[model samples]
Target: MQSLQDALYNWLTIKVVCDVRPDDKAAVETRDFFEEILTAQHSVSNIETTKDDLMYYISYQQGEEIKKRRYPRELIEIMINQINQEPEKYKDYPID
Candidate 1:
């Protein structure tokens, strides 16, 4: 089992599907993004170093619902791209 710190680190850095109408293309993109990240060399999280830094929460806010998604560290770039393309959709998010 992953620890809270592990989960938080992954959640903070991963490319999760926050808000989407559920499309195949998006799903494929997410999957591919995850795979790409998994193959990267800098997959390790420096938890000790970042313990004092400001961390952001990656979640979806639709109406009154605030859903959290657990994303892998490898998918961060893809998630950023998605957030950049859909600024309005992710207005509440700080994916920069």
Candidate 2:
């Protein structure tokens, strides 16, 4: 139970479906943006999206008071791309 809870808290292992159209012809641009762990047991509270990019909200346990940071969209995209390309680099990210 402890490991399961840790897995759930650390990683997002859910299959989310959306009603949208996919363009196969559209080429994906995989930029070597991030080269580190973005989901290394960090506490991610909420993620908000905007017209241009995304808003990544993550909190941290600092002694007593919880600290947080709102990362920009570019960073978020880089992190996602890194996570997707994990254990297999130089591959195009899946269009999900």
Candidate 3:
């Protein structure tokens, strides 16, 4: 506890206290739920990053309408560029 206090004194941080529970049927089947794909339209789920993972999204609300830009455009563009640059490498892949 003393070590934590000393470290916190030098840096800004959030100390969360909660009882951890497994996400069972109640968590997923209930009306309130967050999907594996974070691009879903309804709620924005808070996430904790612990590794080389990233999430990108854009949202806009216009009165009664909720406009969500679901695709990760920048990432998609990078993938497209890779495929364009090496068409022969991806030639064996099937088309939709």
lDDT of 2 by residue, 1-96 (tens): 234233322222110001111221112211101101222323323322222345545454434545555545454455345545573643333566
The local distance difference test score of each candidate is 0.42, 0.32, 0.30
Show the lowest summed lDDT stretch of 10 residues, model 1: 44-53
- 2 or 3, which is superior by TM-score? 2
TM-score of each: 0.26, 0.30, 0.25
Worst 10 residues of 3 by lDDT: 12-21
- Alpha-carbon lDDT of model 2: 0.32
Question: Candidate 3, TM-score vs. the true structure?
Answer: 0.25
Candidate 1: misplaced stretches above 4 Å? 1-9, 12-74, 93-96
RMSD to native for every prediction?
Answer: 13.6, 11.2, 17.4
Ranking by lDDT: 1, 2, 3
Among these predictions, the greatest lDDT belongs to 1
Clashes of each: 1, 0, 0
Q: What is candidate 1's lDDT per residue for 9-47, written digit by digit as tens?
A: 444444234334234355445445543343343243222
Per-residue alpha-carbon lDDT of candidate 3 for residues 1-96, written as tens digits (9 for 90 to 100): 224222221111111100111232332222122222221433234332221233333343434555443333344245335645786764422222
